[model samples]
Target: MDKLLSIVIPSYNAEKFLDNVLGELVKCHNLNRLDIMVINDGSTDQTAEIGQKYQDSYPGSVRLISKENGGYGSTINTGIAQANGRYFKVVDADDWLDSKNLDRFVGLLKRTETDLILTPFWAFNDKNHHKHIPEIKPDDISWGQKYYLKEQGICPVPSMHTYTLRTKLLQENEIQLDEHAYYVDIEYILYPIPYVKTFEFVNIPLYNYRVNQDNQSISMTNMRKNQQQHSLVVDHVNSYIKEHADGLNPNQQELMVNRLSRMIATQLKIIDLAPIQMATKHELSSFYRKVKDKYYFEPKDINLPMRWLIKSRFNLFPVIHYLAILKMQLVHY
Candidate 1:
């Protein structure tokens, strides 16, 4: 039987969580229609061993690929090349899908040929075990209705967790993400827009995204440590919008800009959260100037402090930094 969906697990040293991740998939009734690719990206621990165990147990449904430690994006590139299903999605090893929702999601894929599929996802905080679902679907859009991206008035921006692309759309376009890069998830989301013409929104919360882990890439400490990589991704997104602006329709252009604005805000926040230093202050000014000149982006959509920093042209950064610290201290007290 042809696989209906390919769930790629880009895992590295995920031994603590791989078992549960694979276990949920194996529980699905439609195993015959699901392809689970466990790409073990050069883990020194037992990641490969755990994946191998699942492969041995599930036979055709699960396959393990082991390669050198390239970053998260390389594992996705490998998965795209090796995918044998009609639809493709990436599920981090630390995250798992809702087993109850798997059959229905696959059923939807089996019937629809939309270039993109959007589904709501659960953000699970590991620290407190609280699950929050973002309002991904706009109230106007009916569930299961196919809409053309070019004609749609309001389109929701999808995170890596909330989207699935047609396998052929990716393979035909040769959609290769940045190799050995930290934040190429944004690249994966942005690079496919020009090729995507039709999409569907399903209200099912299929993905369970694990958050609030100290070692997670999106953590504040890691964001500061990897700020340079984040900036590189921002540059790639900016360049992509410029290179493809003529080809993208008005709606598509708006979508890309909204996404870029959010990335810029994040980069600014990373700078703001760091200790006041000459180098970081200089970075803040330079980044703000570049985006403003190139894209006419403003920081008005973010918090007040960030807006003030932008309004002052980042000159009052030191004052804002101390005031923010004081606010945090007062709140904690």
Candidate 2:
């Protein structure tokens, strides 16, 4: 029997793009190798109808579930629970994979049986017909090199929404998404990164991420939600470093902490400037304290400006942290 590959798609009001996304999956070079499961998250639109149409057309190859709206995290968690494949993958409703590269990926997985495989994605805009590709060293790449590629501005990748993970890892870790308005992927993706023993990356672009200006997921205005999610990811990563990452030199620690601090500052910008509920203030304060206490050190030990900035707001830095965060988006866009 062929090993089953489960592809989970969490959808919400995505009818406009679901057809194109599902069509790519159906036309993949190895159709028999995949079991596509799409959990329609209470889409108030025709998303459910579209999914049903695909189910009718593809029958056993495609399965669709219409569940109540529960944000992206809950939707993906539900799909993961129902998946029966030997390996699993996730695709955003807005993104599509390159059908031409499907067989190459499946063949690689069949041969290596790696725990996780990450392939590069093409981020495209309406002005640019071709996908924007990120740079990476061609050969002699280590897992660490591939992992930190984004940090050095070489890979410039985030949101690994197209990764294929072995089912055993999910079952083993009992991995589930956190139900925050943001950071769902971080909880599912980064939380597991440090623990992965056998991970691989392919240079080929297997996914297309549509970055149209009108797309809700790509809105530059929703900086608050995006930054908060980014903060949660960085905090989780920093914690992972302290506990799991060992034998790091001073330079590496500085680099990691610097990145984490910058992300925290950026997140503060989102929370401070955005219109959020009053109750969220406490939650944000708690998060800030956790990060502050963990990283607090003598001012003289590091960069002068960072030290002064950290000290000037000693009690009020979290507030200033939020203000400076407004410009934090400069790093991303």
- What number of clashing residue pairs does each candidate have, in the order they appear? 0, 1
In candidate 1, residue 329 scores what lDDT?
34
How far off is residue 292 in model 1, in Å? Answer: 1.3
The numbered model that scores best in TM-score is 1
Estimate, for each residue in 1-333, the C-alpha lDDT of model 2 and write its tens digit: 464688888898998889998999899767777788888988899998999999999876788988888888887788778877788888888778888887677666676666667677777664445567654333445442234322322122245554777887786767767653565565565545543555566666777877644545434466544775666666566765586457444434443444455556545445545444554456556656776688522223344434444455434445544544544433222
Query: What's every prediction's RMSD, in angstroms?
Result: 2.8, 6.3
Model 1 Cα lDDT, one tens digit per residue, 1-333: 999999999999999999999999998999989999999999999999999999999988999999999989999999999999999999999999998899888888878899989898998978778888878887777888999888884444768898899999999988888878898999999898988999888888899998767787776678879998998989888888888888999878777887788788778877877788888789888878888888625355456777888888788888877775565434311
- Model 2's alpha-carbon lDDT is 0.64
TM per candidate comes to: 0.92, 0.72
> Which parts of model 2 are misplaced by more than 4 Å?
127-130, 136-158, 215-218, 225-265, 271-290, 295-333
